[model samples]
Target: MRTVAEVARMIDHSLLRPELTTGDIETGCALAARYRVASVCVRPADVPLAATALAGTGVLVGTVVGFPHGGNATAVKEAETRLAIEQGATEIDMVLNIGRLRSGQLDDVEADIRAVVTAAASAPVKVILENAYLTDEQKIAGCRAAERAGTRFVKTSTGFADGGATMADLRLMRATVSDTVEVKAAGGVRSLDTLLAMADLGVTRFGATVTDRILDDLDHRLRDRDGWTAA
Candidate 1:
């Protein structure tokens, strides 16, 4: 069984909802610090707030580029990435051009991701495929483009799509990317079992809003099963 910290590190506590206020970002940062989760994937405008709040807490600050819709021009996405990094985003979750991928324009798709990867400099980039809009062939192509562009991870969904991460999609993504490129599952990862199941499929990161519930349940289970206590 994974320890509380291990499970915590797997989560990228989500704070991207448009309606979230500054207070919500602060509260979310506090929770992330308390649990020592991997990072907080915040909205682009909230990067500075999250960065300041999480500073010295060891939790990374991540922001999205291109967001729910991946129709932003490549240069615009690149500019967004650069500005986000400037605003203290240590990690970037960028949405790939879903339409381009679906249209079979693999080269343009690859270039779009590469631009963000370039602008991110040293920051790790996770390319969101928004798999809900993609067929298996498009997903595979997206994964290949992300890999070829030197992204650090390929993610499923932005949580705004109709479908979230499914086992079928996770399996396909895991199989598509090489070992050097990790997989991230977003959407519908509200339970410990779901997170564990995705981890079993080689997912190393998750985006979730239910960070507290998931970690609390894991802590309880570990204590009951092994007399384990959180540090």
Candidate 2:
């Protein structure tokens, strides 16, 4: 069984809400640092602030590329990736072109992902498939495209989508990608149960807003050895 700290290290505490002020980002970064979470995934503009805030905290700084909508031109996504990395971001989760994938523009989609991966340089790039809008075949193809583009992970959902990560989708994504490409699930993973469930399905990372709540609950459960369900 995984320890609370182990699970905590897998969380990429999401600070991507649109209305979040600088104060909110500061607070979120502090919380993530306190918990020793893997990274604080912030917005493009918040990268510098997050990096500065987490400078001595041993936590990584991450950001999104093309964000909630994956329709940005390939050049734009590449620019976003390069700038974020320059701003101190090391983990990048970029949105996939759902429209292009659905339209069977496999070459375009692969090219898009490759652009971001190239711009990411040595940093890892995670491709968000927004599984809510895709069929199983599209998901597989998306995974394959991400792998071909040399991305590190195939992510599910942007939270702005109609739905978030589901076990079935995560399992399928894991099955589709090679061992070199891992999986990340975002949006709706609010509790320890949900996180561990996805972990069991081969998900290695999560974008979460409730980092403290989940980690605290895990700590309490471990201390008491209680049958907590993370509800």
lDDT of each: 0.95, 0.93
**TM-score of every candidate:** 0.97, 0.96
Clash totals in order: 0, 0
Give the per-residue lDDT of model 2 (tens digit) for 95-126: 98999999999999999999999999999999
lDDT tens digits by residue: candidate 1, 31-135: 999999999999999999999999999999999999989999999999999999999999999999988899999999999999999999999999999998888
* Model 1 clash number: 0
Q: Point out where model 1 deviates above 4 Å.
A: 227-231
Local lDDT at 128 for model 1: 97
Q: Which has the greatest TM-score?
A: 1
